[model samples]
Target: MEFIILVASSFTKLLDPVVLAYVIAGFIIGTIFSAIPGLTATLALALLLPLTYSLDVTIALMACASIYMAGMCGGSITATTINIPGAPSSMMTALDGYPLQKQGKGALALGHAAIGSMAGGAIGAMLLIGLAPFIAEASLLVQTTGKFSLLAFAMVVIVIAQRGKVIKAAMAACIGLMLATIGLDAMEPVTRFTFGFSSLTAGIDLMPVIIGTFAISEILMQAGAAKEDRKMTEAMSAVKIRRRDFIPPLSSIREIGLACYIKSSLIGYSVGTLPGAGGSMGSFLAYVETVRTSPNPESYGKGNPKGIAASESANNAVCGGALVPMLTFGIPGDPITAIMLGVLVINGIQPGPQLMAGQADLIAPVLASLLFSAVVLIPLTLFLLGPYFIKIVSIRKDILYGSIALLAVVGSYVATYSTFQMMMALVLGVLAYYMRKNDFPVVTMLLGFILGPNLEEFLRRSLALSNGNPMTFFTSLDSLFFVILTLVFVYFLAIKKPLQKPTGAAQSA
Candidate 1:
């Protein structure tokens, strides 16, 4: 009750009109960034990170939360209209959404997406707000040895989750860990891999790494795309969305049922809690479940709205689920939250078990903004802005990519006013471009970089406590739990083959 009161009190302080404006603007920006192909909310947050320095911490956090929520919702726009998923999370949405668009019900599909996003995001935010405090308390039981195992679990699970490309994922993660070891050593006063540059003492700043990896690499990727790939399809010119088309019919909602929305939301939220298991996974699992249970499964690819419901609801729900470990355990579930974590760190707040109780004032507004964005702004933005989406997504690539390149370089420089960092952004961007071109997963690498320092610190501390006895890890109950958990994940991810059940549109896929 006291914790609830503390959180509620935090909201009152954020009731300022200016703060609300920032949240609204941030959502709009996130939607725009995510609606365009090859862009994401992660990129929007990366661009805004430098600005967080000037903005109040509460306002910055609120903006980030809203942006993250909007990112999930915005991707459905392009998926329905252009048959292109603006964000990776919307891939499942495209399977049904594009077919609906071809049937001239594109606007209706988007409306279903809006409804699903609202329900999922609202439920997810509620879960996050209600459960984080308790989870934080439970997390305190794990000490140094357990912490090491947990991080190792995150790394191994993320790597194996790549399915067919596990080897590539592992290699990428190793590169990240190696990069993390470039700066001053964690325990000793010596550096490990500076390679003789004086400025390398502090190592690479996260802003440069993120900008180079996502923003700059995207620019490079887009630049090299075949001309035919960038052209608008004939179907995009055929459909026109109006204000009235944004309201979903009652019969269609009944067809999907409240149960479908609720179940999909739960799936997304659950998947979001796992490391490297992102929105795409949440939506994919939800969509798979929907197809498996539906009475007329074959109608899915032809133009069924239920698929849209499963995809949007599950992906949007991921917003709340991804935050659980980030706020309580300081571990990022995905790149968007990773950037949001940077926002918290940049504001001089350290995340962990004590963060919620100690910094309720700072955390509460972010949660409130997330819930508000999901429940209110999602439908509102879709309705007000739906008419113009087709036009907005049709902007020329040259202008769009050019502007992004300028922002990427400027953001890197603005972080510390160092030209070296700006140059480093390009260097790292080129490296990431080739890595992506070769099908390597950069996200695991980024996670590796983020988790490497802590993993090393905790491992060393645990070994010291046990007088260098490796058996102490297995002997400790908390550590043993994580070790066993990792093994289970390995069994499921690498060793165990899934039972293939084909139905509906998935039959062809």
Candidate 2:
């Protein structure tokens, strides 16, 4: 009953003009950031973090939550229209979405993506609200060893998921882990990778790496492509989309089916609840599962509406799922939530089990904002901005790429107010460009960088707790489960699955 009242009050708070205005503003800003290639929701949130220092805590939280939800949905807009995903999470969306655009079904693809995002976001929010307490309680059972094991499991799964590119993925992850060690040691005051620089002691910020690897690298790649082929303008102008074409047919809905949305959202929510497992992984896993279970699997990666639905639904759902660990355990599920954690700290609010007990008022409003944002996304994308989004693809390459490059540079520098960061971004951008050309998976590097510190800290802490006894990990049931799970994933993803290929071929022959 008390919970019911809190939820009701939370909804009422959304009616406040200040909160509503921020929510709307955040949604709009997030949409624009996510729609533009080389700009991401993470960059938007990072830029917005400093500004939050001057705002009311509740309003700030609401705005961040709204932006997170909107940004996840926004990525699909460009992914469908231009073949370039605005965010990493939408990479899977681009697989099917861009092909649909080539077929002049860009509007239909966007509509399906928006609808899927709405359903997934709503369902994920409900799950977050309902399961948070239980998940938090369960999380308490995990010790340092268990935590370390869990992060290891996530990393292993991510590496194995790259399939044929596993070696490159592993190398990229190793580079990220090495990069993460550049800052001060987690347990001691010693700075290992400073290399005699003041800025190095503070460590390489995630913002610069993120912007460099994704935004700057993307800009360089686009520039190179434009130089090689000047026909983009002619090609874009050939595809035409009408406002009336924006509405998805009922057949699409029926074909994708309600079950697929629910299943993909559940997958996203589950993945998001794990610390450091992010939306990109969630969406990729969900899309893979969708194709595996789909009766018409051949239709995937070929302008299939179900593919767009599955990818968008899973990625958007990750927003709510990601908050579970952040709110309940003070553990960020991804880089974006890590920034949100900073927001909480700046506002003198510590996130953990006690957050709900003592600060239900503030937490309630944030949760309400997530739900409201999801509800608003559908109408905003499909009705208000759908036609404009379709026209985005028709814009000249020079203007679009030029503007994005400027934004990426400005945004990276402003985050730290340091010229060093700008240089670092350019350096990483060049490195990423070469890596991309060589087929190395850059996303793995980012994931490794994000999770590496946590993994190292947890492992060191666990060993220290047990007096350096390696058996400590095996002693705990929770830790043992994850360690065993990691092995199973390796077997399925790296060994057994590969070994079965020749056997199957021989049998078929």
Candidate 3:
């Protein structure tokens, strides 16, 4: 009865106009922030974290939650209009969204994305409410050895998920791993890849490299295409999305909605609750599972509505899911959650069980506020912004290319103001271009680059705990499960028929 009163009171407080306005503002700002190149949800949240100092904790949490959800949805704008992904999570969307846009189905695709996003957010929020205790319990048991094993399994899955030649994928992972080794060794103080240059000590920032690889390479590739291919003559016309289009006649909203929401929510929560896994990992896994389970798996890279739906849904779901561990425990679940955690600490709201008990008033109101934001974003997205964004395809390519190049230079230099970093970005861009042309997946490389340092750090910690016993790594149930999972995946890959490159729609431009 006491808990019910607390929640009811919190829900009443969530109806305040001031709290409502701030959350709406966060949604708009996050949408625009993530729609642009070179800006990410983490950076956007971090920039706003200081401002939250003056506000109430409820307002601060509302701002963070709204921004996180809107940012995930905002990535679809670039994915559909420009063939570039504004966020890492949007990369999977590009597999079909861009293709559909080129085929003049941009408006239709955006509608699907919007609907999927709403469903996913609702599911994730519901899970937060209903399964919080269970998730918290699971998180507590994940030790260093378990984390390392999970990372290893993630790497293997990522490699297998690549679109092209297995050998090329392996090479890309190697490159990413090698890039990760450039800074100081994780356990030992000895520098490994730095060649005595002071700039090398800081190592390369991943975002600049990613921007150059995907954005800059797109520009270069476009420059080489025939002028006829570069033409943008298509008018931005509204495409009607009848109820029939989104919820197919054969698939009821009850069935499709439940499947998309549950699968995406679970994937998002499982991956998002993990210490370092983020929206991208969740989106990627959801997409792969959708493909594997779909009745027509071959339709994935085509203009398949279900494929687009799965990726969009899972990525947005990660926002609420990622927040669970961050608010309940003191640990950051993903990069965006890390920034949000910093904000909480700065506001003197230390998270964990003690904070939950001591600060129930504050925490309850914030969670209630978040559920309200989801309600607010739906109409705002469907009625207002959905129609306006389709016109982005009318923009000229030359101007677009020039603007992207400028942003790439500025974004890279902003990190350290080093000429060496700019030079490195260009070098990486060139390598990435060649790698793509030869059928290697850049995302596989990105996974390895992001995970390599953490993998080393965790391995060292686990070893130290075991007193140099290598076998101790597999002692944990979580570690053993992951090891077995990795082996099973590898065995499947070995026995699976050789990949036959499809000539038509599945081919990347």
Candidate 4:
């Protein structure tokens, strides 16, 4: 009874007209960013950070949070309309989404992605309401030892969770980690890999690196091929969502929905909370986990709605999940969060333990923004934006790819107007292309780059706290459990699984 009242009261606060308008504006901006290739949520937020400096924290957080949430969903527009994925996290969506679009089910695919995102966002917000206090309480107890162990566990899982050649994944991860080491040492002012280039002192901005690696590289690889028309041939029946198709059967929804929601939410939250692991990791990990556990795992690469649900929902959930740590600890979970950090600091709201305690009103509006933004996005995406999505497919592939390539270079240079940034983009693009040819998962490499700094920082901090004693890394119960879990995961992924590889039909059976 008390919980219900509290929730109802919170709901009432979100109904403010001014708050609702800002939330809607944020969604529109975010969706626009998602529609453009190479324009990521992180970059979008960073660009807006300075503008938010004079605004109140509530408005600032709302603007940033809304963009982060909608950006994850907006990627599906390009993923479905064209073969290109607007976000790396939407790559799997491209596999089936584009195929469905080619079959003239573009509206259906868009509908599914949008609806799945809404469901995921709603559930994630619910979880936030229920679990924030609990998670925050637990996070407060995480000392340096526990933080390092948890980070280590995340790295181990990232490598082991990758499908295909584990060695290649490990190699990619190492490369990313090395790239992360290019910046100055966290504890010391000494540079590690800058090579005396003044521009390299801050290391490479993660936004440009990722944009170049994924978006630019993708375009360059495909630019040689002539554009083929992928426009939908059959006319969409109607904009209506059929009652039968509106929701899965109760039993099916109960079974698959629970699996999708829980797995996606947990994976989404875990990855989102981790310093470097972002929406891409969250969605990819959820999709992978879904495949690993599904009875019809073979259906994943196809247009399986379950796979779409898992990926879409997980990525969307990451929006709110990411905010928990950022708001509470002042530590950005991923690239977008780092940008959000900039926004918060610009707004004169220093995020940390005192944020929630001292500024509950500001926090409430941000939370309100998450719930309301989705509500606004759904109608806008379904009705006003539906035709625009279809229109994107009409653009020639040559033009699309060319523009993306140019943007990748421009965005890279804008991050730091240095020739080295462009060179790094080209080099990484070539490496990524070769790596892709060999079936090495580039996403894992991205993850390693993202997590590398945090892992190093945490490890060093843990060691320093214990006077250089390695045992300090496992002083807490959470740290101990994660260490054991890491070892067990490694054994299965690296060793035991290889021993079970199929020699013939015998293994298949």
> What would the TM-scores of all predictions be?
0.96, 0.78, 0.63, 0.67
Per-model RMSD to reference: 1.9, 5.3, 7.1, 6.7
Off by over 4 Å in 3: 1-113, 128-137, 226-232, 235-374, 464-468, 489-509
lDDT of each: 0.86, 0.78, 0.66, 0.66
Residue 452 miss distance in model 3 (angstroms): 1.5
Error of 1 at 14 (Å): 5.1
User: Cα RMSD (Å) between model 2 and the true structure?
Assistant: 5.3
Give the lowest summed-lDDT range of ten residues in model 2: 500-509
lDDT of 4 by residue, 1-509 (tens): 33323444655655777766666777776776676555566545644543464566667777777888888888877776665677776766666566666666666667667766777776666666566656555666766677677667766766665646767878988988898899788889899888878777888666555655566556655764445532332222222223233333456445456667667867876677654456777777777777778898766555666666787788888877877766665555665766666556545576655666566556666666676666556545556756655444345556755665666666556544666777777777777777776788676676677667878988887777778888864666767877987788678655674422112112211
Write down the TM-score for model 1.
0.96
> What's the TM for model 3?
0.63
Query: Rank order by TM-score, top first?
Result: 1, 2, 4, 3
Instruction: Say which prediction, candidate 2 or candidate 4, comes out ahead on TM-score.
Output: 2
- Candidate 3 lDDT for residue 211: 52
Clashes of 3: 0
In angstroms, the error of model 1 at 172 is 0.8
Tens digits of per-residue lDDT for model 2 on 265-376? 9998887776555787788878888888988877888888888888888998998898987887665667677667767865778665567667877877888788888877
Candidate 1, 253-286: lDDT as tens digits: 9989999999999999999998899998888899
**Per-residue error at 68 for model 3, in Å?**
6.8
Best by TM-score: 1
In candidate 1, position 118 carries an lDDT of: 95
